[model samples]
Target: MSGSEIVGDIAEGALLARAVEPAAGEAPDGHTQETACLNCGTTLCGSHCHSCGQAAHVHKTLAAFFHDLLHGVFHFEGKIWRTLPLLVWRPGLLTREYIDGRRASYVSPIALFLFVVFLTFALFNLAVGPIHVEPSAVIAAKSGGVQAEADAARELATTEARLARARRGAADRRSGKRTGVRS
Candidate 1:
């Protein structure tokens, strides 16, 4: 083909491609998709809404859900890196800085607290399994000999009586009849 005709064809192809491609912040369809804050109706430009602090985009996929969870739990990004030093060595300075509104560089106090608590509990659970105990052994250790046996018998009798009373009260309530019990 001649140079002029080739150029014309390329321009036409470019126009067609541009027409088919969606614009930024738009869905596949021709309509302009809302990247606005679902909570407050403000236009969103980043990961979170500027006006309401809500996430701009919510992921519907399971992989994205897990990615978010992992990111939240483990990813310190730049905030933790900036906050940790001051928090560990000069907490007063950190607090002062945060209170003075120089907060963009550091993690928020509540977020740091929650993350530390979560980390502590997660580590503790990993290090130590659920506690197990034998009820008879525990009771025997607390009490000794005939006294222990007598205490156990008394406790069993009391428990049985309480259970019987509870059952009677439930029955009365179900039957829509008033019993001697106040409730």
Candidate 2:
């Protein structure tokens, strides 16, 4: 593969990973539990134990892991769905709200990008209409955009061939030999 293709793959992988992962410090259970008591030795529960204000609970389960995973995905999807309509129409509202820390109400950028990419590719493949056009003036017009690139490539090849001939002639002159000439 080309360098750009490799780079693109890496970038795509990174973006997908970002979309799949949860943000840092975002509590899975929306609550933090304390490990130990300050005044007396007591097992903590729910932010505080009524006796002291300490954190509560910790994540420790396979179910909890999967739950957090689903939570992240659905949370992101929910935000995207809510923000997408307004984003498509207003545009400014989504940006402003996001900048103003209304992030909880909207999908993150990476998530939205991934979702959009996935949807676009899926829809494109599933689309049944005129996916392939018959060869005609319309098709020619569509291809005309690439005509200049083809012309440039032809010109480059011609120039390179001319340069090669010139180099060969120069080498013959330096060696005092006549090329392509009968004795």
The model with the greatest lDDT is 1
Estimate, for each residue in 86-152, the C-alpha lDDT of model 2 and write its tens digit: 8899889878865543455566665566667788888888885447766797878878868978999
* Candidate 1: C-alpha lDDT: 0.72
Alpha-carbon TM-score of each model against the true structure: 0.36, 0.32
> Could you give candidate 1's per-residue lDDT for residues 1-183 as a string of tens digits?
999999999899868866876353255542334478655667879767787575656553456656655665565567898899999999999998766535456676766777989889889888997668899888887777778789899999999999998998998899999987776
Clashing pairs in 1: none
Q: How many residue pairs collide in each prediction?
A: 0, 6
Q: Global CA lDDT of candidate 2, please? A: 0.64
Q: Pick the candidate with the highest TM-score.
A: 1
